[model samples]
Structure formats: C-alpha cells, structure tokens
Target: MSQGDEQRTAKVEPLRKARPCPECRRPSTRDNYPFCSDRCRNLDLSRWLKGSYAIPVADDESKADDDYRD
Candidate 1:
C-alpha cells in the first residue's frame, strides 16, 4: 500500500477504561474480572434488591385523568 493509502487506514480507537464495581470500587473484569468474581456481582445485586435500584412505574390512571369525558 502507498504511504497515502497507509494514512487512509482506519486508526484503532483505544478501549475505554473499565468501570470499577460500585460495591468495592475495584476495577471490573472483562468476564467477571472487574468485580474480582461473581460474589462481588451478587453483592451489587443485593443492593438492588434492598431498594438500591428503582424504576419508576407510570400510573395508568394518570393518562385517563387527562382524557376528556363525554
């Protein structure tokens, strides 16, 4: 390949740094490596179980409240 062609070759983007586990602040593994192990993952899961994680459930009646009634 010509020098210009080489220049045209796509540059490899560096992978972003792995995020640390919320429970231990330890670097997470590619395959359960970051948490150090599944135990850590479960520890994080427990937090969610105990109300650490919450997803808002929309109230069905709220939509009806906005509807016009005959």
Candidate 2:
C-alpha cells in the first residue's frame, strides 16, 4: 500500500527454485521435487542400481578389532 510496504515486499521476495530436473530438464514440482516426476525419479534410481550411486562407509575398521580386543 505504501512505499515502505512496497520496499519491504521487494526485500522479502518469494523464494525461487535452483533449477529444473537434471534427468529430463523439466520444471520440478515441490512434491516430486528435483526429479520432476516418478518416471524421472525411477530413472535416477536405475542409475543408482547401475552402479552410479555409492554410499560412503566409514574407512575405520575399528568395529571388527574392538570385539577381538575385548
């Protein structure tokens, strides 16, 4: 309504998305998020199954040694 209000509105603008889906490059929804859709999400999953994903594990092998020590 006023200049101050307008200035405040401008300062507190709506948040924007980083980018579209990486697989299909389509605009992503908040539900499906970065994948865009279930198909794209599954595709990404398949890529993981195809050895694209690697979950890091701790390199410290202390667990095995701890049992033997005690």
Q: Estimate every model's Cα lDDT from 0 to 1.
A: 0.76, 0.81
Q: What is the lDDT, from 0 to 100, of the residue 69 in candidate 1?
A: 58
- Residue 58, candidate 1: C-alpha displacement in angstroms: 7.9
| Candidate 2 colliding pairs | none
Off by over 4 Å in 2: 1-18, 53-70
**Model 1 TM:** 0.43
Worst 10 residues of 1 by lDDT: 61-70
Q: What is the alpha-carbon lDDT of model 1 when measured against the actual structure?
A: 0.76
TM-score of each: 0.43, 0.49
Top candidate when judged by lDDT against the true structure = 2
Q: Find the 10 residues in a row with the least total lDDT in model 2.
A: 10-19
lDDT (10s digit) by residue, model 2, range 1-70 = 9999888778554366556998989888767778789999889989988998788766777886796898
lDDT of 1 by residue, 38-64 (tens): 999888779888997888775897777
Question: Which candidate's TM-score is highest?
Answer: 2
